[model samples]
Target: MFKILFQLLAISAAFVLTAPVNNSTTGISKLNSQQYNVVPFGHVDLDDYLSNSTTFANHTYLSAPGSQNGLERRGSVHACQGSFTKKLCITGSNAANLVGALCHSISVALEIQSGNHNCADTGVHSVSDQTQGTVYYKYKTTGKGCTTTAEPGTIEGALHKFIKEKNQDKICDFVCIRLTHGGNWSGYVGLGTSQDAVKYSRCDHEIGSWSACVNGDKGDR
Candidate 1:
């Protein structure tokens, strides 16, 4: 009897040891483990950077009252010229920075959608307009320049939290970026269409879901 009992115990131990390891509870899997390849923007021609662009409306307006007098003064404002949009023309060096920032934003959005943490600390800040399905994210940071590294996992929980509260189909059509310089002033990098971003990054498949989330899917259900 003693010999039989020992044999049974040994078999049970072997079974426990040979059983496959379960990772479901730990939450580490290939589906959620995909890595994002983030690359910096090199020297890009400003001419080929944007697609469709509109000219800034030239206008003349009265200046606000200044300390000099309580009367409003007339002023003339001249708009930027060229095939490129006025906004991009005014951005200067910040244009390249905006491109980098946009790439980071897309990566964060992808991670969040994939059930990963929000990568907020990636220096991509966002503001959403549910009415128009438009969202904008500004990139700014201190100590670390725009080239700072993003955390491996998501760090912007609030951003993801906000995204979750909204209807996926109503997501913004354009994810605009506002690049900051000197910690105070900033400029807008307006690319013609979200497709411009797709072309620039060459990550169409990677950003496919995010594109749908930004620009509502108009396909037949």
Candidate 2:
């Protein structure tokens, strides 16, 4: 009787400690995981790189099959949601000490469905690699360089966490880098639709659903 009582108390305590409060979720629907031959901007022509690039590097040009004549590493295509305004998502591994989570100066820009625009003077909307079936968790505060330029930082955090969790406690994939740089920064992460990418920001909402979303359906369903 004493042992049973102690076990019950321990379980109750565990529940109290682990229970979540005011649970909420956000994001878009995730695309099916598919292999993507990433053509790093470095490999593409200077003009093409500037137009369709997310990152800039001074590395050698290594060719990746299935990629345009200009590509280096082979990555995976994560998703492409929003009809009129779509996002071609991709992800892959990166060397440590390469990616940046540094949030310094930030700026915001919005492009309503219009013409072909270039963000060279500002920021580019490029994708990054993350673990399969993973999402980002943010913890932002003002006056910490994270406020003005929080989107990329938030993405970095999520990708890092997802990579760490997917590796099964392995350090081999401890880092994830981004493709975009300074000048063009957006500080939001919620739910985004092709029609309204700004307000619809969350990944789960963009991809599909989150377990916490009221209308979310577990995979089993």
| TM-score for each model | 0.19, 0.18
Instruction: Tell how far residue 33 is off in model 2, in angstroms.
Output: 11
Q: Which stretches of candidate 2 lie over 4 Å from their true place?
A: 1-94, 98-152, 167-206, 209-221
lDDT of 1 at 192: 22
Clashes of each: 6, 30
Clashes of 1: 6
* Decoy 1 TM-score against native: 0.19
The lDDT, on a scale of 0 to 1, for candidate 1 is: 0.24
Best by lDDT: 1
Error of 2 at 24 (Å): 40
Q: What is the model-wide C-alpha lDDT for candidate 2?
A: 0.22
